[model samples]
Target: MNFPTHIVAVAGLIINDDKKILLVKNPISGWEFPGGQVENGENLIEALKREIEEESGAIANIDSLVGVYSNVQSYMGWDGVSYTPTKVILDFIGRYVGGDLHTSDESIEVGWFEKENVLQIIENENLKDRARDMLEFHGKVIYRVYETKPVYSVKSERYI
Candidate 1:
């Protein structure tokens, strides 16, 4: 059954000089920007700031709302429990105003890379596309929806 899932969230598509973007490589594998789920009763901007701080240990000022994404896919647990088919995430463009980029409990290595260079190592095709869209469009916002489901569970998927 398709359950009602309106998980409001915020993410930072942070950028720097030389057309470089900030991304993190986990202690495991793959690469992604700093983001997390927005908590109950918290404003979107507040959630973005809090997630950025916790994930990258940097204080950032959100620049603008870039886009809203909703992708529906199947999910299954390690123990084989079926869950919701899709989870939607709201993302924003954020700028690092102050603080240092250091490793935190949520990340292992964080660094900025050239836009061309970053595209190759992102691991997930969809995420790479999203990053490219963010860079190319700049202030232009977008809304995306997915109808298909993944063969593997969401937990095993590279990115959410």
Candidate 2:
């Protein structure tokens, strides 16, 4: 048995209402987006929908592509476990269409946080800035790649 490696993508759904961002506390990380590894045979849009729904128990309507980032900086190396970052993520702006808002075992807590109050909930400044960037695509989305080395790239998405 083997796990698929390349082309594996995860996604974070950014939902904002009245200038507040919806963020969830990951069971491992303090708080971040509700996302997971994209399984084989699933498209980007489908993976985003399933991940967000699974973690937050809410159905989100796809709004637009916000950005993509690496999950390397947030790896969990518990009990002296060696960690290697290996995930490419696509971030999107998902709007809450319907469904209950509750936290799953994958999360510790779930709720929306404002820019000013995001610090109290999420400790990662990088993620906070990314969250802010989600509001406005900045005319481009940040793409960081980590293979034999780390590379930073940018792309302009027609949607965001």
Instruction: Identify the candidate with maximal TM-score.
Output: 1
TM-score against truth, every candidate: 0.78, 0.71
What's the true lDDT of residue 36 in model 2? 72
lDDT score, candidate 2: 0.65
lDDT of 2 by residue, 59-128 (tens): 8777666766654443434656765455666777777766777888887788876756765666655555
lDDT of each: 0.69, 0.65
Residue lDDT tens for model 1, 1-160? 9767655667777876445678876654468777878899898889988988787777778886666676666456335775654557677777766677888776888888777787787876556656665666556677776533443222222222
Each candidate's root-mean-square deviation in Å? Answer: 5.3, 5.2
- Residue 85 lDDT in model 1? 46
Q: lDDT, candidate 2, residue 124? A: 58
Indicate the residue-level lDDT of 158 in model 1.
Answer: 23
Clashes by residue pair, model 2: none
What is the lDDT, from 0 to 100, of the residue 75 in candidate 1? 59
RMSD of 1: 5.3
Q: List clash counts for every candidate, in order.
A: 0, 0
